[model samples]
Target: MILVTLLSFFISLSYETIIFCSFSITITIFSLSFISKYPSTYLVDYTCCKPPNTLRSPSHSFLKHSRLNLSSNLESVDFQMKVLARSGLGEETYLPPAICELPPTPSYEASRKEAELVIFSSLDSLFNKTGLNPLDVDILVVNCSVFSPAPSLTSMILRKYNMRENVKSFNLSGMGCSAGLISVNLAHDLLKTHANSNAIIVTTEIITLFYYTGKDRSMLLPNCLFRMGGASVFLSNKKSFRKQSKYLLLHVVRTHIGSCDEAYNCIHEREDSEGKIGISLSKKLTSIAGQALTANIHAFALQILPTTELLFFLKTLIVKKVFKQKNTKPYIPDFKRAFEHFCLHAGGRGVINEMQKELGLSWEDMEPSRMTLHRFGNTSSSSLWYELSYLEAKGRMKKGDRVWQIALGSGFKCNSAVWKCNMDIKTSSDGPWFDCIDRYPIHVS
Candidate 1:
């Protein structure tokens, strides 16, 4: 009888244990199912506007125009022009009509015209490509660092599209070129909360108004660097649109070094001694950018890098910190292993060169950025899209490939976005590079 009772007790305990295990498994499966049902944000399509032919300003034309406008010594102007030509910008980049003309004073009307032309053209193309009615857009984000007018950019977009009455809209000003990715992150968060929502993000900078006629060499740099361009992107978290999406956002990392005094004032907008207003880029910009990028990448690696690469990086950190190895350099995990394509910002030749050296990137890895700079100059926040478009125009993007977009800007900020190609992207006839794709990868001195 005692043996029988013990056997019965064991059987009851085993049965209860089996019931609990089954319940846990069911809960796990249900949780996973619920998680899978949540919507995922996707990039439906993007378009970069090509400035009109009237706006095209080759290097020689720009140099001649600058000499005619500025009161600086001919020698100084010539030196600045030479620096600009060697700044990795090609001969074909376009500037606003006002800039090409080098008006005696900055023209607000000309600035407005340039902004309207680029923004409208880009949005028109985007809407046409995606067949997305503007009325369906639930959120609108517009970023232009230097040009925020009385009728805000977002308000202008809303009026142009005649969007729905309650559409959420925002205009980000003084955020610098990195504001493009910041807009993307904003849209992502909004989509998560709104569910099945669509957002439009427009990035551009108005060069006409920001153009400096002043002789301050530092202020005059913008006169040489910035050109006319803009980009518009459509994002959606609707599951029904997944089949038509081009890419899925994997991660976004942003780092700002504004707390540091030097970084905060590195790229500043102020009036020169002559009371001529312009943005001054400090000589230490490249170093500040490198530091910001390093911090941003360290954060990014933790999220996207493979375990083996992470382990190696951790080992290097341990060796440097614990062992006090003075000569050892911190390991830059093989980012090439994590990403198949790279779209480093076409900020300038020096910026791109610095990034290449720091990341140990191959020439092929830097081609898109180099080509974009050569073709478009620095379009500010829109520059990254132009680089991405170059990759597509060259037929380099493949389904499932990963692409990384990095941008650095004023406020000493570094922003990065990682995307996985969800579908094969074909070159569009109306793309920014469509006419000049064949001539690209051209040697630029």
Candidate 2:
């Protein structure tokens, strides 16, 4: 009987050990799950560089500069002046120093100087705003479509700032205006893969190389539209930034129609009759850009639209595609239902007008874009940030507000990034639009 009692006690001890082991194993798995999960990305802040007022090129000054470049060709001069008057750019827009000079000095040294002027100025402001250490940045992306010289823009930033030895750097050239959001999309994916990190995207177009002396009316449009500006944006997946960050990145949608023959050929860089290199815009650009916008927004709507809108969209699709209903109009979703604000790329007045008509947005919805283009001509890839800055300067951004940023460029590409405001945001005193924000919503007619 004593031996039997001892044997039963040993069995009870073995059962308690088994239960303890099972509980410990379960706790280990729960902790590991948190470690393996992807961290959310945030836009801590951004800075847009406004060159000194001395560089300001009002309409008369811009016209005078153009005449010299077209000095020998009277007809071309007449054509450009007409384009400029209707270009929707206001009197206060700026031009780079090199382009403003007579016998314009668009040399290798001049281009680098332009890069240093814009890039460093923007980075200086960005670092001061966020108090982020330069050495802490783990990833860097810089883009300049026209000017990519030796010791690339990325290397210049690295050497100047002394980034970490293992910093992942990417330099994008020839990607055109859409490259800004493209870089955003790229940085977003990288943040997901590399946990607890910081990234910076610097986007701008070098105006020095953009001027075309040859008389291609197509190429001359670029000369009239583009101006000098750059933007530096900060993004991070660091958990500590969650409380202070301005925007939480929600979604990014990119559409490239470059595979189609007409879309691919609509915009190209080539030499004119005088062997002068420039980017030419096709007359078909307006319609082709419309096509790209439609394709991009359709995909974006599917992900962000509410269930009711989604159902309605699918019903329209079935009626149009499956039933072959010839008379049914294509259903356009009410984007305002999903977003509180819009930062459409201010490509030009024409491009902004096209977006307004296509998206069924009101004039108030189009203010930020129109004002950005007027105040600062097409800054290429960096244009979207200036528009965002306009909204903040006006104190329009509030906690929980959602902003949809749409960017289009020469690759026949349209890319969109959706950002949800993490906190109520007001522009600091240093933004490009800070002084002029109250004066905007100007009569662009």
Candidate 3:
């Protein structure tokens, strides 16, 4: 009986060995077939065989260390990335009691005081919400459309934060509201090179400094439209740091239209003899924006989505073509399929209304933009984030969700950025915007 049992065990072992050998041969053959079908590129680090965070074959300790060093090196590459920070500097220096009242006769000092208040007030709103420490920021970029402060806004931020001497900085003025996204586009490029770097961007329009208190309704629009606003956004390319970040940079599209006088006339600032500064909105703005959006959309379509999806979109366009439909609106690309949240620019009642009419978005979908206009009164470039904050405040943002922000400004430009949410948005009851979020969808005059 013992001899019979041993023979059976040996037979079973032989069968198992044969099966293992066959499986190994099949895998080797399949691997060869795959390698032959694909071209090799040195640019790819072929070692990342699995999706992010998936367990894989162990690497040699030395190889792991080398990869870490390489990633660290990438972070130092000289590139531009827009960041939002150092608003506190502007807040501390400006505002009530310091310069209690406006001067009866206009003076540059009054403008300076108002500008200072604008910068600081906007900064205070941003930093208080973000809870970011001043010293931790590695780069600074600032944009003030009309006023360029002495010592440069960028330098002031560096001094206020006591940032490292080696930290990079940039200040942009007269670029208009679209300048904010341009700054962001630059920042994204910088981060692609410097993986560990963090950049801060502060965006505000001190229209009070350029206030047009003239009799012309065109000049008076600034007083009714422009209000105080500032926003700070932190950007990092380090894979480890992005796990909880609000949005991932997708694509940025810019178009320069109507150059020379005709172009500049679309959205330009001019002052009367009394030194009352104001922004003029031409009747042609809507048309210029339409053309620019068409161009921008085509450019954006080429980058983020797959060729098949693009083909499908084109086919839909062909099938649903409209020749002279009255009250025609821009095609609202299936953003539901593309993004989970929408932070459309809160330029004004007309701007918001036009976008909603064009995109066919419901009032619920436009909660953020509408609420911002009501509370903040069109904060210009920084208005987008305030809208985003509203969504976060309402506890509506979820992980793996997406956000789309579209801004319209000078040059008749319409710029947008897409963000993919990395985690559930957490709201603090302490926010200034918290109580008011519940009362949105209000009528705007």
Q: Number of the top candidate by lDDT?
A: 2
By TM-score rank, best first, the candidates go 2, 1, 3
Pick by TM-score: 2 or 3, better one: 2
The sequence of per-residue lDDT tens digits that candidate 3 reaches over residues 24-55 is: 75566557645532111110000000011121
* Superposed Cα deviation of residue 60, candidate 1 (Å): 2.0
Give the alpha carbon lDDT tens digit for every residue of 303-392 in model 1. 777645655675566666655786888888898878999999888888888899888898889999899988899899999999999989
- Poorest lDDT segment (10 consecutive residues) of candidate 2: 6-15
- Candidate 2: clashing pairs of residues: none
Candidate 1: misplaced stretches above 4 Å? 1-38, 102-105, 321-324
- Residue-wise lDDT of candidate 2 within 161-194, one digit each (tens)? 9999999999999888899998998999999999
Q: Order the candidates by lDDT, highest first — what do you get?
A: 2, 1, 3
Model 1 alpha-carbon miss at residue 327, Å:
2.8
Error of 2 at 356 (Å): 1.1
Candidate 3 — which residues are off by over 4 angstroms?
1-107, 110-133, 260-263, 273-276, 304-309, 316-332
